[model samples]
Target: MSKKLRVAVIGCGAIAQRRHIPEYEVNENVELVAFADPVNERAQLYADKHNAKAYMDYEELLKEVEVDAVSVCTPNALHAPVAIAAAKAGAHVLVEKPMAVSTEEGTAMIEAARQNGVQLMVAHNQRYMPPHVKAKEILDSGRLGKVITFRTAFGHPGPEGWSVDGRNSWFFRKPEASMGAMGDLGVHKSDLIRHLLSDEVSEVGAFVGTIHKEGTDVDDNATCILRMRSGAIGTLTASWTYYKGGDNSTIIWCENGVLKIDTDPVDNVIVELTNGNVERYQVGAMATNEQQTHSGVVDAFVTHILEGTTPLVSGEEGLKSLQVILGAFESQATGKNVKLD
Candidate 1:
């Protein structure tokens, strides 16, 4: 607890390369200890860059290296297994979003960390976005009154542009990804909306489908109508086929007016009230495939471990967001509203 936290990255793919690795390097409190990936070249590349040891198997890395924490950035299928092992190894865990592919798996991961007494945090970076942070502040300050409805969208050309392997990325493989855009993008917004409004999604009605992606059977588009426990209603859309560009914007309509977050070309948060008053804030830009920015996920994870504090997106929080998306999947299959218990 007094020295720099020894850390290992369990996956060396795009997310790790773009966010976790560089972020960890910036944190003086963390020591880059090791990396593991099924593809030795990928893991070795990052390990060599940071002068850390590399392992082809994460299990071996966890067993051999004395790491204090690990970032689980593997494919969706490996999240539970790797996180559980890290917990059992007495290492804190920072698993990427869509924590696991199933409710049972997520539950087990949470239990593992609980039993082991190690911090288990899911990397839901939207909470750290400048606009999102400001929006939460405004909402909590009672400036927005009460949110009535909202529409949030997250989209890009496809994961081909973001994934390291291009077209053949595990993102397109149904088995590896579990859910496509819904898992990749939808879950982010799900967690964000919940964070922003402090509300839990109670009912979900959705239309999920594989529209234009050629290499995958997983859904490429998801349009969901969510009713929260507070009786607030909203719509969420995630797509990999937004050919023009990415849209990471959310508009929350409240009793007073609408709070627009990341909608304007230059402004980060624009508050437009019914009284014809407008307030614009230029906080910071959100990261994209074209422009990589600092994601605060790693810093939070490290600080939580060092300070012995529960993370914002704890294992339980990640499971709740995952359940929202899973409910969307169920609604898509059954053509009925899927209620979260």
Candidate 2:
């Protein structure tokens, strides 16, 4: 058998600890060889658990560990710099969602990967969900006919109650990350909308505010109206103070019928026709838990590296999604629709 690919995970935070590291542990094709975190204890904890080297500084980890690739699971602001460093170090990169806080930073990551001749994949795991895969298939099959309009929504009960440390919740900090619900949850909806519609967003009109996050520098809920290049209309909502279980759902209105991409863990997708008929699609295989989803991404990453294939979610795709997030911010700031070229 070919040797397992050596992989390093940067940022041993909740995401890296709960998702990326365990995934690498379970995947037989990949080896978790090193771990890094600004916090020495956290890095040490991860390394001890996974039997890998640990470093407080990511640069030191990069230099000391002979990693085949690295997973950039750091803060929103650090993604581009870490990814660029990994690419320059001759390692492939798999960056977590939203790519970066700005389009310029995202572009820099992409350019660095291209210049370094390394594969750069973004962890837009929702795209790999069975419901999303089925939706993409239906869209491509022309069953939805010409896509006319789409509505997508995702929400949670806010991360303040979920993070390990309530005081250091990065989701509530704008400088460390960006907007609240928009970056954390909104980007996923935007990504799924783009994925299902097979189109680029042309313009954005948005409303973002810190209505529920009592003392945060970021928004807790936001909505964006999107105009697709293909002349399709769509609406996306991301929130943190939802009354019920977390929701990730999308409804696409087409010429023939309406297709629903409900990424809710229970009911994935549903389709309805003009004749009042309905059909449900339950797509499962990839695990729904964070760690399992990370496994799916890791498997894809190792496979692409070993087999000489392209990533399922390329850096360019991540950049597009980031643009939508940024555009929404701009729209919210100007109180006017932002246009995309």
Candidate 3:
């Protein structure tokens, strides 16, 4: 039998406990070795459950434990620093989405991984979902022809209900999260749209505001217009005011038909042709916070590490998505379109 890759998880927060740790536990190619968090008790609790070492400081854990890979599940502000340190420590890094708060930080992380000859992957799990995978297949087959426009949205009642800290979560704080709903949820749609259409966002015009939450400076709602490299125009929205629950869905308009994903309760992907034909596919419902599932991020990251292959959502790809969101923020400030280079 082949040896399993030893893995360490930094930040035993909601993401770590719910997705990274649980998924890594089931991966045959991986052995969860250590858990690290600022809170000693959280780390100890997960360590006890998983039969792994626990540390309150990630720096200390990295210095002592030699692991094949590490998942940086820290906050938005720490993503780049922790990922860079993990790469330098000779461990492949799997960082959560948005990559970093700034493009420079994201670039530094990529450079560090490159210098160390280690893989760096971002946890943009939306791209790995079954409906999204099938959507890409249909798009690539030219069945939808050229994508003319798209509208994608991701919104929930806010992370207060989901975070380990509840109402006092770092997600609502500016220093730790940078941007609220835009960074927390919008980035997912940005990454997903880029993957689904195999294109890049070239320009952005946006309206970002703190409309829903009290005592939070970060944006709770954002609506942006994206001009894709392929000349397709689209709108992306992220919000924390969906009190009725979350809504994550996308609709793509093409020359021949329209593709509706995760929109209808009866179907996962629906195709409405310009003619009289309609196609409906049941690819299973999209995963939600309350109904978490294997996001395929850990499995794919481990596969790349073991096979010496590049990850699908590489650090560079993640940086591009981050830049798009950042551009939206810039657009919001200038009240004009911001073009990406």
Candidate 4:
């Protein structure tokens, strides 16, 4: 580990620019070695910025380049294949969230990493946010008692605002994105609720719809009723139609009080106990679609790779959270609650 850890980013898109590249650039131990994207210019753009090699075909990049880590920022469908290939090539992988379209794919990615003795980390950045980290600490302290329920949401106008390609972004395509807002936004909350509460969703009932966006076949809005293994029930909503401002908030009602996060326009975390005591903490703000901030994912992934340790969001954790979203789809199609196995 004397030399800086060599890193490469697959799929030089908006996320690579906003989250991956910039964060890696700031990390003192990482050396960005290469970049790859389907679009040659996109790959070259980031490559030029970092003085790294560029490739259009990621497979070629893998075959020719030797790197210690790779950030898989490709479309949802490609997450598994690229990660598996990278793992087999002896590179630890930090893949984007909603790890894969299905559990089978996610499992394969995990297994590939396992067989190759490489770490597989998922980019579930919400858990790394200042407010969320503070929320977890408060909840873990048992100052609020056991969390009984929560109403969490992650919504924005749509991918057109954040995606590099605007409306032509792969986020609008079913084949590329797998699920729309749920995959894009909700999975973060799904993983967050599980992280803060330390529970798994056992059942799900959802209403997934393609409302508003006339051209897209994928859902633009999703509301899921989740039943955690601990018997805590709550609602999780993901939407691409919150036009006024982005909503990235979570309100957890515990046995003794309620904990509000990212809700107050001014405060970071709020505590309203049953005894009429109100406290506010100024942890920090969440990064909106219009803002560029450090996600903390790249640094964590690099650290895990260097230390040979498990990440906060490992591939298995990613698969379980992904199952919750997949269950939502099943529930939406059948109009009945889907119990995850």
What TM-score should be assigned to candidate 3? 0.99
Q: What TM-score does prediction 2 earn?
A: 0.94
lDDT for position 156 in model 3:
92
1-341 in candidate 4: lDDT tens per residue? 57998999999888888899899999999999999998999999878888989999999999999998999999998999999999999999999988999988999999999999999999999999999999999999998987788999999999998899999999999889988999999899899999999999999999999999879998999999999999999999999999887799999999999999988888999999999999999987888878767888988888887787899899999998899999999999999999995
Tens digit per residue, CA lDDT, model 1, 1-341: 45999999999999999999999999999899899998999888878888999999998999899999999999998899999999999999999989999999999999999999999999999999888999999999997798899999999999898899999999999889899999999999999999999999999999999999986899999999999998999999999999896799999999998999988889999999999999999999988889888989999999898889999999999999999999999999999999997
Give the lowest summed-lDDT range of ten residues in model 1: 1-10
Runs off by more than 4 Å, candidate 3: none
Task: List ranges where model 4 is wrong by over 4 Å.
Answer: none
Candidate 3 positional error at 329, Å: 0.7
Candidate 3 lDDT by residue in tens digits, 151-212: 99999999998999999999988999998898989999999999999999999999999996
Candidate 2 displacement at residue 4 in angstroms: 1.6
Top lDDT model? 1
Cα lDDT for residue 257, model 2? 95
Give, for candidate 4, the lowest lDDT window spanning 10 residues.
284-293
RMSD of each: 0.9, 2.1, 0.9, 0.9
lDDT, model 2, position 67: 86
Candidate 4: residue pairs that collide: none
Minimum summed lDDT over a 10-residue window in model 3 is located at 284-293
